[model samples]
Target chain A: MILVADSGSSKCDWVLINNHGEWVDKIKTEGLNPLLLSKKNISNTIDKVQHLLNKKHDSTIDKIYFYGAGCGSSGSGNLIKDLLYTTFNQAKYIRVEEDIIAAVHATTQEPGVICILGTGANCCYFDGRRVIQKTPALGYLLADEGSGNYFGREVIKSYYLKKLPLDLEESFEKEFGADLNLLLQKLHNVDSPNKYLASFATFIFKHRQHPFIENMLHQGIAKFIDSYLLNYKEELLDSPIHFVGSIAYYAQDVIKKSLDERGFIVKSFIKKPVGHLVNNIINKNIL
Target chain B: MILVADSGSSKCDWVLINNHGEWVDKIKTEGLNPLLLSKKNISNTIDKVQHLLNKKHDSTIDKIYFYGAGCGSSGSGNLIKDLLYTTFNQAKYIRVEEDIIAAVHATTQEPGVICILGTGANCCYFDGRRVIQKTPALGYLLADEGSGNYFGREVIKSYYLKKLPLDLEESFEKEFGADLNLLLQKLHNVDSPNKYLASFATFIFKHRQHPFIENMLHQGIAKFIDSYLLNYKEELLDSPIHFVGSIAYYAQDVIKKSLDERGFIVKSFIKKPVGHLVNNIINKNIL
Candidate 1:
């Protein structure tokens, strides 16, 4: 079976294709970003995946394609590739890349803009084979303009500013207790600030239609377009733009509206990119 | 003796003037904003003032003019006036007004804009007698456009986004740490989120020359102008705007730059409003 894996900051999705170009199985596992997890953590996660796969299937896994968060740079990609090779000896071939590439492939890379809006965010100009141009994602701190982290940070601000309705404040305070010190400690002290902030975006999703939340999404998406897509102005206008992430799936209207306001057409929205990667791997080898 | 009291969110400054208009004594005490403090707290603060005056030769303290935060509304102003009357029997007259009025008075109410940028922010267009037109101050949550709270929040984002230099990041992490959860929890759950956020603005004050901080100040100040002053295009251009607040005093260059960029001239910059208030109160009685 040929295995294709797409890992993000929070979780990883895996798709397996059999030798005859037939689908085998699909599963999900905990996230494994090398920048966030230690060597021991990576090993433990790999072990858990192996144990789960063994219990579910009798067939042996062969080729593996791993695209993940924190693998954007060559150094980080090499480190993740080395770790995967040491763990999966039965796998004949392994290719590791930044998760954005998988998103690009999943969207067919048909001369358009591709964006990842999970815990953090990234965007690239893809022309089928490779990313011709890219902007810095800069994580949640400096950027993450239209991602979960942005939503999460805005939720905290809205609650503190008393911009939200009383009921929303009561719910948020009951759940999070309006303690900024503790929130800041967790965000800074923990390994994953992106996850820490993204946890709050769920609240925004719950109140997506509210004026404050709507305004936030409008401003955030405008900023994202201004910072990322606008840099490739000539290409963005002519090409189709697509998004890949859970937020894109959940907040499609917001994405669509923002794109409309900026005069861009969204070609597609794909939540998971592993399926497309699996198809690519299978077709390239067989066809 | 005439008492001029300037009460802000964090502290209150009291200036005593003798019969000849000579400065007698100046004292500082804990802040007394009715919105944040209870009736009992206000009473205790007044008692402290009486006790301090009693320590020196006090022959029935006369002509008390009090300017304070939360006094912009009639209800809050009446409550503060009632508290003063119950506390000081010898005080023959007591005048209560909004803190922004004090800021306007300090700037001589010269047909221009006045802004207060302490722990929070308030702005108004003054025509000598009263605020001719006003925009909502709405605390730090909904507004506080050109204030410390706004700058502090932006600074924290810049730090998290790695936009700051390595040296600055190390300094920030060492002082504030990387944990955003704790920072956020304290900001929300603490006694005052506005104050908590404003505290971080001091960091920006320390590094005012840094390009990142400069950019942040520009963005914040520009947004403030865009939302408030810029809306009154005709009035803004006709008059010379003046500012009265700690942020305005400290970051005068930034304020000047923000105004200059929009082609608005500034008449004056005052650190405190007590002098202006005294001048106004005296002028009103004389007239």
Candidate 2:
């Protein structure tokens, strides 16, 4: 059995796959970014989810493929690997990769541009085998062009500026209970500002029918295209552009309209890519 | 004697004024944002600059007025006021206000709009005596549409995407000694990523002559206007727009062009608004 995981800054999705390429079990957990979580925290998280693993099959699990945010660095990756080793000593083989690569592999088996629109935004030009080129996603602080976090940021700004219609503003106030002071406290005093800001996406999605939200979503998609996608114009325009993330999945129609107007084809938009990765692993049998 | 200071996240400019409305002394200190710095750090900063106040004048100095970024909340403002109290025990009065209000006071005494285009971007409508209407500035993370940090972000993205001209790319690499790995480490592991990111604005300012950098500044300014200035269209169009900050100061030509095309009159662009703020204090004598 092989364990496949897809993790972002917001959440983690795990799938246990058998040799036959079928998912035996699945679990979800809090996001585990090595850069943010300590070894003890990660260990505790794994312990919480271990009950989902079959006791009989635990020993049979020979390999674990962990792809996640904050695992790109050697220091962060090593810390996670060591923690996993302590917990699952049975898994003799372990592979760790960045979430972007996992997103690419999960979304495309052919050469094309893959974009992840999650709590953060990132993109890369992936050949069938590996990523050939990528644009720097300066993380949620500087970039995150079109993402849940991006939209959430907009929602907060719009509410504070009174840019949204009065009814929508009232709806937002009721949903998030946000004021300038409380918003500042969350943003400036908290540890996970990205998550805090992205949480408001629920409100935006719930009110997607509102003109304010629709226009905001359009601007966000356009920015994502201008910042992350336009760099891969030649390849992205010709080849199918694959998007993987909750933002892309939920906002598919808006995304499709934006991409279509820009003369691009979006082949797939998957909310969660871990299942696809499980299938990819089984079909390839690389493990 | 009174001390008036204008501070942002990057630096604080301080000026001392006598009863006769003449400038006595001036000094600059590291940026002090209460949200980011600890009590000890703020104390140490105060100690470093205390020598500027002569021992003979210490007892005579009765008032200190500090306006800065991150000082909007009573909590943050009180923290700084308490710290200053500990340092300048002789001073009987201490006032701390947000930098946005300082920018408004410095740039205009009549009803108009004031914009701060520094490491971050913000704007407000001033009705002679107080801010009546204003746009919310979501700091460097989400908004900061046109700011030094915003331009620095673009520079890093341009370099990583290999989109810059060959010479400019080479010059940037030489200036920052940045590659993707180093950049990631700086962004992910370090404290005060805002300062680290804004430091690169030096490269942008130095190479502003290049077409790429020039156009990038233009886009940054345009975005700032669209996101912030355009919201107050009715009041801002008829009112003279005043800009204050390093970005607005250095990119005056670009800012003028963008503002002119948008049909807004430029009042003045002051690099360090501390001088203007000092004059405002003298004329108003509100302290």
In TM-score terms, which candidate is top? 2
**Could you tell me which 10 consecutive residues in candidate 1 chain A have the lowest summed lDDT?**
A133-142
Model 2 chain A: worst 10 consecutive residues (lDDT sum): A50-59
lDDT of 2 by residue, A1-287 (tens): 77888889889898888767788888899888876555677888876656558554544777788898878767777877787777777788888888888888787778889989988888888867768655665667666878888888888878876678999988987887866766776676555677788888878789989887899899999988888888888887568899999999999999899988888999999898888877777887644
lDDT (C-alpha) at residue B196 in model 2: 73
Instruction: Give the whole-model CA lDDT for all candidates, comma-separated.
Output: 0.74, 0.81
**Steric collisions counted per model:** 43, 0
Candidate 1 structure, TM-score to reference: 0.56
Candidate 1 per-residue lDDT over residues B174-283, each given as its tens digit = 87888754564465345455667777888887777778777777788887776666645677867788888888888788888878877989888888777666666666
Cα deviation in Å at residue A29, candidate 2?
2.0
Compose the digit string of candidate 1's lDDT tens values, residues A1-287. 77778899888887777878788788898777766666787778777777777788888787777889767766667777777777777877888888888888777636888888888788888875668644555555345777887788778766754456888788799888966545544654465667777888898777776776778877877777766667677787789888899877777787888888778888888877777667766666522
Each candidate's TM vs. the true structure? 0.56, 0.89
Q: Where in model 1 is the C-alpha error above 4 Å?
A: A58-60, A283-287, B1-216, B221-250, B255-287
User: What is the lDDT, from 0 to 100, of the residue A76 in candidate 1?
Assistant: 62
Give the DockQ (2 decimals) of all models.
Answer: 0.04, 0.40
lDDT of 2 at B235: 87
